[model samples]
Target chain A: MNRFGFFILFIIIIFSSKKLYSKNIKVCSTCEFKSLEMAIESSCNYDSIIVEKGIYKEFNIIISKPLTIFGKGTPTIDGNYRGEIFEITSENVTIEGFNIINVGESFKNDNAAIRIKNSKNVTIKNNFFENIFFGIYLEKSSFCKIYNNSVTGKATEELYSGNGIHLWHCKNILIENNIIKNVRDGIYLEFSNQCNVINNISQNNLRYGLHFMFSNDDTYRKNNFQNNGSGVAVMFSRNIEMLDNVFQENWGSASYGLLIKEINDSKITNNVFLKNTLGVNMEGSNRISFKGNDFIKNGWAIRVRGASYSNSIVKNNFINNTFDISYNGNINKNLLHKNYWSKYNGYDINKDGIGDLPHRPVSLFSYVVNKSPGAILLIRSLFALILDFSERAYPIFTPTYLIDNEPSINKSE
Target chain B: MIKILSYCFYDITRGYWISIYLSFYLFLGFGLLFLNNDISSAIITLMNIVIYLVPFISLIFGLTYYYSSREFTELLLVQPLKRKTIVLGQFLGVSICLSLSLVFGLSIPFFLVGAYNIENIFDLFVLIVLGCFLTFIFTSISYIISIMNDNKIRGLGYSILIWLFLSVIYDGFLMSFLIYFEQYPLEKISLAFVLLNPIDLARTLMILNLDISALLGYTGALYKIYFGTFNGIIVSSIILFIWLLAPVILMLRIFKKKDF
Candidate 1:
């Protein structure tokens, strides 16, 4: 044989041998290898360990080998409130169908149910996490998929509770079909990019439902966030697509269905914000498209703070809200058009399905409320109504330029 | 009081204008519900009607009823009944009849639309309560105005003016005052003004129940601290009851010493 032919034969032999040597290890009470730690210690790389349904009282189980650990049934891995559980450091590791519980919370250490550090091509699927400080903490991990998991925490306060599905410096992560509740944040992404968070139901969280900070180029769609402290906050992020999410019933003194702060070049479309304190509380956010959203029965539908510029708010329905749009500044750089305001009293004389008169959404009462929140006691009073009427009749005390020129005559369904 | 109330209710129910008023409300409630196709939006439209039109119609109707029943009132005054009993009975009769008209007109359509479910029943109940309060308060005001002025035209003019001032002009003055003193903290002062006007007080109470106090923002928080609680409801209800009672008492005092 020639030298090139010999080299090709050698490469084929090595690849086949590696697959042939890979074996499956079974760990159960009746088996010789009864414990997970003993099975991992005795196993080689690319070995699969099948653990049976039983309570394993263990903590700090570090996986450094590229192995697949599958539970025959969902075996409980109780940390017993000691420390971290399942600290993964190897690539191509799969931990599936495990019930992880009682992760110890520490102020100094960030304890998690499953902490993945510098791992790639990891799949953590079909897991149940309870009483965890941080569930599924991914640090500097890439190409990870955390799918079909349920994380429920008894988080009372923000300081003590960590996030469910916390990602830091992760890339190309797929977080899908997870039910997360009562955590500080349902899903928190910081400095993580190019991730897809899809079809998650995040409800009753202590703080934000979905929080994004400094993360860019992420797509979050079809998520339901209900009754959270402050629904979703996308702050200091750019080039994000948040579509088809339902943010509902997040009502409080300073709660928002979607709080957009300093985010730019994002598309927030087809979202429904119902009965929040503020539908979308935006500050310094620019160059965004807020279209096809429904703002229903909120305190202030869209409260745009000062310095937000060049955003397009079009084709949305503002139904039964106390105030449609409230701005604190005089410089109107945003475009408000074709939105159906339920309070628009203008007539459609031209028969074009659009009102001839522009609808001024920022009421004088809202402006005053923005200045002195205490003045809200006068809301719906005859005095406040008169003030709103006069401000609408005469373009004074409100930003005159901030008017929807093409207001819809009928409510947009 | 029961006999007198029954007679007055039957008489008012037979009046052509009361029937017109009932049809007007029924038409408005059905029209707004059909046009909006949502209970919340329909309630909002009805709230505007209740706030503005209810007091106006009640004031006008109460003043006219008192003047038109002048002979009947004089006949009752000559009977064995006390002046207080006669005046109280007639006032209750007018207020209750007007309240029933409003309740039947507005709530019948709400019931037809199946809106008396768990969620919206409270809202509908609050609306009925507010209508009753406005009827009681404004009818008493009109009764006082009618008793004070013997001339029918002057009494009618005064009643209209009082309704206009309470519904429109008082708010104008309050707005001007708030604008004039925009620098100072106006929370307490604004709350005081709200309590002083029965219409404003009723609006505040309704808005509080509507859960739009969050829109009030900071002022909403303050009001919530007051009106969002059960104690707040009791306090505001007492104030509204006082508004309902004071003018009636004054009218009774004036009727007792009148030279009629």
Candidate 2:
């Protein structure tokens, strides 16, 4: 017998021994193992428990073993206003196809429908969570997958509401295809690193749809955030890639489509911000690149407050925003390059789709309103128009260096 | 009064001036709509032009029409009509023709472009209605200026100055005042100043219907309190109506006691 032939037979024998050792356990009211807790306790490692179709009124179903729990007909686990339904502490546990409800309301401890603590390689998929304090709480966990779940919380007050999916000090989590509403924040990450959040719908949340604080290297793409208090807030974060998200209709004095505060080394590309009070309220954010985004019909698109430095705003379409680029001070440290402004009426005589003259985005009326907010009442007045025209002909009050160098004459890219 | 109003209406409509004015607005409306390619944005451009052009054209046309028809006005004054009837009837005749021409002209493009299905129809309605108010307000103001001054050049110059002040100079003064006294809480005071000018009031009314109202409320809670309610709209429109009435009543009184 050659060495390669023996190696293949040895691999087949090891796989056949694992299949021969692991067994399936049945869980139902009429079955031998009536309760899920008893079934989980009696099952051995690497065993699969198939739960039948019945209402199991249980709470604190702790999983400290490596077992895969699947529901045959999606059985209901009614917590009945009790504490945490599934507390996963061990690694390599999978929980799928169950309806969890009525997690006890504890504002201090945050009772979640499914709470995974200090566990790795946990997979939770295709679950329905209703009337819970927190939907999925991932703490100090790594390589966790939360997929295809729906979380609806009956939260009204900001203080009483918990987030739909809260991650604290976690790493390398994937949260995709989740629908969350009526929570404080749809998805919140605090100190969590390298998480990928994609294809989520978070709308009508009481606070921000997705909030990241001190979470680095997070990529969120193709998420729809609408009608929340604000769409997304990334504060004190770095190396974040936000791509192809749609933020719309978050309208208030304090609300913005995306609030980037104290963030650095991030890329925001190809997102559409529509009808927000202020789209991209940027403050103290440095070296961030904003490219190929659309700002449509917002009150203020990219209002740069103090200390936002070296940010290159390139190739974005600014269509019908009341003020395209509102800067508080006169020091222009950012680059405005090759953007399309609908208000740019400069001649494109060179016929390269770029205007012949540079376009000055901020008007004197916007500056006056910034100086004295009462002057906003004079918007669109003929006197304001005259002031803008004269300031254009004779530079004053507006930043002279803030010009779109290659302003597109038409709406292209 | 009705007979004199009808006679003046037929007399104005018989001239090519009314057709030319109507066609100018039609061409402007269609051009703006074509240029913007979006009905909502087209309404914004039309608002800017209407606020400036409606008053300027009304002031110029009102003064010129009044000056050119002085002999006809004297001929009607010697008839059995009361002075109140002659004055208000001729004023109503000019106001109605201008208002109808503006409203009808701007609306044709909207209907043709199917803007009536979108939500911008209400904004269009406000724009044209404010343009009408501007026509009435400025025509009455021009009548006051024409009646006060016997010299044609002085009246013409005075009308231009008033338009300049109301449309341009008044906002400049208000801006400088706000910037100068920016320390004080001037939301209410500045709102009161906006109410004083009919042109600014008309502009404010149009702005309230657009998304820019959210920006107006972004200053402070005081701006939101003042400019965020239906009562704010009602109050502004009432102030605009008062601007129309006050000058009109004064013009009637001055023309009644004039030595002509």
Candidate 3:
């Protein structure tokens, strides 16, 4: 043996003694392996199973160890057109570029296209889920990044359906850049904390585009919720920031662009509300800062009721709403400052951008809805004419404190 | 008749009729109840029932009327009865069937939930009936649409389009106007808009019943002074009647002009 052969022997020995080893396994739908579940079950550590591009009918593939499953060009793992396809129970798992579909609907079971239960640091990306019940559900999971995935479901009713991306009891999750449509909820967070949802488009969901319930310390930015039935609702949550999101085309008598209930210490800024029945319906919400929002072409810009205290509505553009602001209670603890009122006829003095006089937004018609239920028809009559003028003159029927003191002369971004 | 009855029965009894609405209404009722514990669940439940029942009954009945007019037209037209009788019969049949279903689905569950007193439930029952009447009003219009168009898809599409326009777009336009005229007195404008859309009137009725009208604010105050009493219910009924009557009469007039 020469010096060169001895050197090659030494290198091979060192490489073989490494901590981890990987193997690539190719599985096709036509293969005798029969299912993706079989292929996954048979795989081991440091294994990369590349699934072929076909609809492989399988269900409930549980991965209990570290693995990397890569699908080549959107290989679909359908639940035989029936149930949950993948349930991950391990840490350090990656499921990339797969189409998971037809998750089962059952009251007895919680089915998902990909359910990550009790897992951490799991990365699921670039997957497509079509007509699934629960797409990418994470229950009791933490520190997961679900990125660049699209989940679509046709949920007619709320009973037999689930959300596009549901995170329950999850924390420190980053769900970014996903497009979801026609599900019960596009993105749902329940009892979830510290999640970041960025740059997602959720449209036409049956119930809500994005629903957060008891989910605290979350920030959702640059998401578009359009034409959903009830729009987006953030309820029973606190310490949240919803920035630069567009909530539009959610129009129904009971619907609103954003419904905030029982929320405190949150910031809703730079949001666009268009063509919604109610732009923002705040109930029992306190200390919320709504700034620099654009309320365009909505029925009611802000409908405040019950314990909605100390909310600051500042630098918002109230453009083209039937009612700029409606306040039911006598107590107007909320503050409206420097908002651009399209209806404001007051002149700007001192070369400042603020209006010379405060804009009193509460209309007498809202007062009629409170005092008498039958006077809505007289809306067209001259009687409504005199009453509104009298109220505006006296400023008595409407809440005295519900005044936008520093209304902006021009709209702000 | 039996075939139609069977189809309607199957649609209703198979749990398909109210599932969509039930899910939403129940969720809304429970959610609101839990969120605002001070506000009675009865209020939420009543509002949910009214909101869900009115539109759903209208849509389903409208579609069913359209379907029957399209599907069994040959027999319907060739019958010995006048076109008015045939149209009215079909309209009433659908209305009755759907009203029955709404009553069964909502009233029984409402009683079970123990949300309201007998008087309020009775009042709700009357409101649901009125809602059914509103559904038939639209159904008759859909029937006219069916008669005018040879294509079922076009007819259905037109109905849905009109529904969307009235339900979504109209309110948006009104809101836009309100925002533009924010400095002006908008109480009268909102009331006028509500009168134009019977759904708005229906919603007002339900909300006032639940005492949630305060949520609408100063605009709501304008309405409350004018239309926020028991007399408002009477006005809503009148408006709903006009909404039902006008389209149906127009449909009847147009039906005579239609080739079918």
Candidate 4:
């Protein structure tokens, strides 16, 4: 009986000590731990630090402990335009409700507002970042969540600007409910996999709003990308699912709502591309399914440039675009079916809601415009009309097999 | 001039061909609107019809009217009326009647569909203005041809030739030149070419209003830089007005010098 009581007492002591070790440390001007660096230095593992509302002029803050840092009233961490504000290298760290600003600009170093390197299960939430070189950058991190952060920067040129939420060699990241603007690229992923980027607004960036390079098996949904220079670019990626994104007002000489290059096995559905120079400028993309997308009031809905094959564009509404589809090559390899083209003039004699005649989405004039852009000046001219009419009648010049066999007789609701 | 214009207007409006022309456009306008169920697409289809068919119908009808009214013109020549007054009266009458028919025929369907409230009013206005310009320009050209050639067949043939040249062959030559000289900077040359053809000018004006000049690609960018501005619209409208006045004045000069 005495030995059993002693064992129970020892277990109770271990539990109490564990609870005592994980205590809250207050960091304020009047507190014992006046500075965050001092508090972090004295705190144990799994401790919570409550930082009060004040300006902390600190840079190169490296957090190596698995702790929780909570800002009570949005304490500002001013990096003084010197270097990175936060560098987290520990797993299961939570940094919440802080205002991080003024990350240093460097040509060689990618100084970020919050840099996570070789960390796992980190949560960075409710942070406001301004004047950042790179915002919330992750390097070799996995199973991270970046939630409800606002990152704004003054990015005038691409050479000096960095991305807002950049992920490099990361996996299983959930980046959601963030607003990013005026950076080089809003959310950039390079060599990352299995990232879920959802419900984010990215606009007014110096470069693309969302850029994917060598990233695969990623899904981004319900994102709004607007007025960014050159818009979104997905390059050298595979198995990307982009759904219900609004790509709007991205207008320029060579701009596109989505510039897809060398991508494969992607599904782009239910997206609205409005008022852009080009809705989708695809090159060398294959086996992609584009369905239920609305291309409205764009200059060119789709400009297929280089050897795209086996892509199916189905059930899309192409409305009021200047050119619905412009193809560069003569080889017809893509499948276009059941799309409602505003320019279609075929009839439905049996009233089955499908046109009796096939709709040719690619006009001969579009082929000419691709060959010689100067011929665009003669658009809507009688010669262009005659050329298009004769090509329709004779099935020459335009690719004969590039036709929509099942064009929707009525516009899809 | 007003009395002569009113009399000519009454005679033309009562003619079966004018009624047929009005009904044709009316049917086309309503048919396209009902079929497309969208104002923008209907406008696009109607624009093609207006650019191609409007000038064709105007030339043939103007030429035939000029030849058929030769007796009336001779009877008026015996009166104290000035040749300028009589010719100008007839030209104004035919152009106005045709323009009225086009406007009424195209607008009724838009009204029935409530497109005036839904669409850009300026685009519809520009379409009507372009249609009127084409009518005035083509009718004046036909009148000049009729006055120059007393033989009806030759006059009709010349009218058809002018129409075909302006509407089709001119664009073909311009396209070929652009293609052959693709390496050269053809922005200015193409702009000049578009201005020289009244049909192309009307089409360009409509395209500018449609805001799809961006589809024109590089040349479109050049056009947008020049014609996408307020000053561009003013300048283009002035040029179109000049195109209207030049043909009428040339026809008047030839009519005054003609040995009828």
Candidate 1 clashes between residue pairs 3 or more apart in a chain or in different chains:
A373-B218, A373-B219, A374-B219, A376-B219
What digit string (tens of lDDT, one per residue) describes model 2 on residues A3-51?
9999999999998998898888999988999999999998898899999
- What is the Å distance of residue A192 in model 2 from its true position? 0.8
Local distance difference test values of all predictions, in order: 0.87, 0.89, 0.75, 0.90
Q: lDDT ranking from best to worst?
A: 4, 2, 1, 3
- Computed on C-alphas against the true complex, the DockQ of each candidate is 0.46, 0.57, 0.02, 0.44
Better model by DockQ: candidate 1 vs candidate 2: 2
Cα lDDT for residue A129, candidate 1 = 96
- Model 1 TM-score, 2 decimals: 0.90
lDDT of 3 by residue, B1-260 (tens): 54454554454445554455445445654555445433333554454456434554565455655565464655767766566655555555665665565556555545555546665665566566656665666667666666677677887788787666665566556644664666676677667787887666666665554433434444466566666567876776788888888877877777666666
Report the CA-based lDDT of candidate 2 relative to the real structure. 0.89
Report lDDT (Cα) of residue B32, candidate 1: 77
Question: Ranking by TM-score, best first?
Answer: 2, 1, 4, 3
- 1 against 4, candidate with superior TM-score: 1
Chain A TM-score of model 4 comes to: 0.93
lDDT of 1 at A138: 96
Candidate 3, residue A119: lDDT: 95
Residues B1-260, candidate 2, lDDT per residue (tens digit)? 89878887898889999999999989988888777766777788888989999999999888988898898889988888789988899899998999989988999877886745546888988898889999999999989998888799999999999999988999889989999999998877887887788888778778777766667765545645665577876777678778889989999999999888
A1-413, model 3: which lDDT tens digit per residue? 99999999999877775435666678885775656677777888667778878877788889887788899989877786566788899988999999887778866677888989999999999999997888988999999999999989979988878899999999999999999999998999999999999999999998999999999999999999998877789999999999999999887546779999999999998999987878998999989999989998677888887778888888899986767887767565677788898878788769688888888877787565444433443332223445567787777758777788888888896
